[model samples]
Target: MFLNLLTLGVLSLLEGRFPARRDPGQRPLNMAIWLVNFASASAAPLVMGAVVAFSRRTGLPAFPVDAWPPVLAAAAYIVAMDLGECLFHRAQHAIPVLWRMHSLHHSDPCMNASTTVRHFWGDVLIKALTIWPVAAIAFRPTPSTLAVYVLISLYHYFSHANLAVNYGRWSWVLNSPAYHRIHHSREPQHYGVNFAGLFPIFDVILGSYQVPDVTPQTGLDETPRGLFQALAWPARSTPGRSAAQGVGAALKAPS
Candidate 1:
């Protein structure tokens, strides 16, 4: 939590000094989304602890070298985790039912470090319970190694910040802020591209890679009403109605 706050403070200072967009909105929806995720995060350690325990005993094929150096093991875990994330991230866009829940993360008009917290709780839990275990089962890393991966993943907060950093020639190797910003872009052409979380090679291999010359707008046509409405969105969402509209209808509907 301290690490996340530290990164947030640093990136916020950077954004203030050299903002990519001069007039990002107040981001009320983003705040609501962050609060929802933040409130649930109180229980995240409990949930993840259970997951790690189950994964430790899952009986899946484990990576053979149990005594590998911490740095090497972490590097390997990151590669495997990033690959899984790429597939999962792409599935969230390609699969309609999943998109309904995932779309809330992209509805923030103002991009900032806090935008990293702008995810549906259900989506957060689902990814946590499912995706992390799959990689844990495969790698069978020490709990300490897994802990390191969690620490690194927190950098996603930094990567999603409003600062306009592209990592220049190194963009292909790592997921810079600019690379991820394109993933959240509102332009039709940018949709369903740049799905990798930490690395861009997965997108390059899967053919969803894109690097735009211009910065693009971000957000959906319909956005959630408020905190409760955003919380209720996925359950109420329909094909015809926007996610937020469905949430609004659900809020008004008889219990």
Candidate 2:
């Protein structure tokens, strides 16, 4: 809770002083999204806790990394999980079904720290399904490491901020706002690019990295109007076409 407040406070200040764009109208919608996501986050622990209990009872093949030094174990877990996230992010763009749900996040026209909370409720379910399973069976990360990972991942909220910052020579190590902005770019050329969350090295390795010439036009032309519309997006389909087809029209190439 303190981390959430600190992140929002700092990013809000930065964005107010040096916004990438004036989006006063988007503020309310952004906050609504943030609140909804926060509610979802609040319930996530119970869901994950249940999963962990189930995994333990089922005799899942969990790796015992407890014997390793704390620092080394934490470092390894961070890298492994981030790598998995990068791959899953790429899949979110490529798989039509996943894209349907993920589109809500990318629908934010004005990228800011608030845009981090633009994820749909389905996104929470998706995360619950994917992440904990890996953590349970692949590597049993210590509670301290998990807490540290959460703090580091929260920086992603800042990464989406309107601040015009980039890591320059260190872009490969850290994912800068400029690097992530390119992923949110509306251009077809930028589709399925820059899937990194904490590290841009994945994009570099996978050939999805593109240095933005300009901020580029962001968001879909037909973005949802309010929270209800955003939440209902995955279900809203035309008479003849499925939602997947509609999303596929917007996302041309996922490379």
Candidate 3:
């Protein structure tokens, strides 16, 4: 928790120094969404515990990594988790039901450090049921390895910040803000691209990689306007469109 707070503080400073877009008004809404999601995170351990219990009862075999050296085990865990994240991220864009939950994260026009946690509260449960369980079953990482992964994943705050940092030729190596901004770009050409969370190698291998070009405008064309609308996004009615049309529109949108 301290690490997360430190990360947010550092990234917030960087965002202030080198903002990609200057819109202070968006911060409060972003922070509000983040706070709600953070509070909801208390249930994550319980959800994961249930999954683990079910897996144990079913005799689902988890690959053993405890015998490996700490550094090596951490590296393997990172790769495995990152690959799952990349695939699930693509699914979030491709699957309509998932997109309904994920679209709230993309609704932020002023994507900054706070945007990193500006996700639907339900997304945690969705991931707990899906990708995270698969990862747990596959790797069964040690607590130390999980801690390492958490520390490394803190880069996400920087990646989503409003800073204009770009890696140029090295963009494909790690997920920099410029690299991830392309994933959040409002441009149609950037749709369904750069879905990798840590390593862009997954995006490259999966044929979804797009090198960061000019920093483009981000956010959805039609977005939830307030906290209530964001929370009720899936059930909210679109004026002239049917449910199918709304789902189709979400599927057609850029991730």
Candidate 4:
């Protein structure tokens, strides 16, 4: 928790120093979402515990990381978990049901460090039911390995930060802010590209890689207005209207 706050504070500072774009109002909304998620984070361990238990019951073979050196094991685990993240991220974009929940993350017009934790709270359970189980079964990662992954996952704050930083040639190897910003780009050309969480190698291999061209504007064309709409995003509908169209109309409606 302390580390997360420190990371958010540091990245929030960097975002101020080198902002790609500013929407001062968005930060408070992102922080509110983060607060809700932080309170809900307690349930994560319980969900993961259930996932691990289910994996054990499956009796499926897991990677023999215990036989490797500690550093090597950790490295290998990170890579595998990153691959899982990359695939699941792609699924989130490709699958409509998942996208309904995921659109909340992409709705942040001012993608900043705080936007890293701006996911809908229900995404936790959705992932627990889907990708988390697969990862648990495949890796059977020890507590230390999971802890290492959590530490590395802090890169997400940096990745989502509103900075114009990108690795030149190395952009294909690691996920930088610029690289990830494209993933959240509002431009149609950038849609469905650059979905890797930590490593971009998976994107390269899977053929979804796209170099960060310009720091494009991020977020949906029609974003949810407030916290209520954001949380109720998936279920929001009106008779004879598509969800997207309804949302668009809602945004256009008078206060």
| Tens-digit lDDT track of model 4 for 83-170 | 8777777666666667777777887777888888888888877666777767777766778988988999898899989988989789
Predictions in order: lDDT: 0.71, 0.74, 0.76, 0.75
246 Cα displacement, candidate 1 (Å):
16
Comparing candidate 1 with candidate 3, which one achieves the higher TM-score?
3
Writing each residue's lDDT as its tens digit, candidate 2 over 151-233 gives 88888977888878877777778887788888887676677677888988887888777665467656765677888887787
Best by lDDT: 3
Q: What is the lDDT ranking, best to worst?
A: 3, 4, 2, 1
State every prediction's TM-score relative to the real structure: 0.84, 0.87, 0.89, 0.88
Query: Which is better, 1 or 2, measured by lDDT?
Result: 2
Off by over 4 Å in 2: 23-25, 238-255
Report the Cα lDDT for candidate 2.
0.74
Candidate 1 vs candidate 2, TM-score winner: 2
82-154 in candidate 1: lDDT tens per residue? 8988877776766667778877777677667878877888776677677766776667677687688879888
Residue 60 lDDT, candidate 4, scale 0-100? 70
Model 3 per-residue lDDT tens digits across residues 1-255 = 788888888888878877887754366777777776775677886788688778878999776676777788778878988998887777777677777777778777777887888788888877888888788767777787787888898988989888898999998899988898887777766777788888998877877778887788777666667877767866655422222322333234333
After the best TM-score superposition of candidate 3, give how far the Cα of residue 253 lies from its true spot, in angstroms. 14
Candidate 3 to native Cα RMSD, angstroms: 3.3
Q: Which whole-number lDDT from 0 to 100 does residue 62 have in model 3?
A: 74
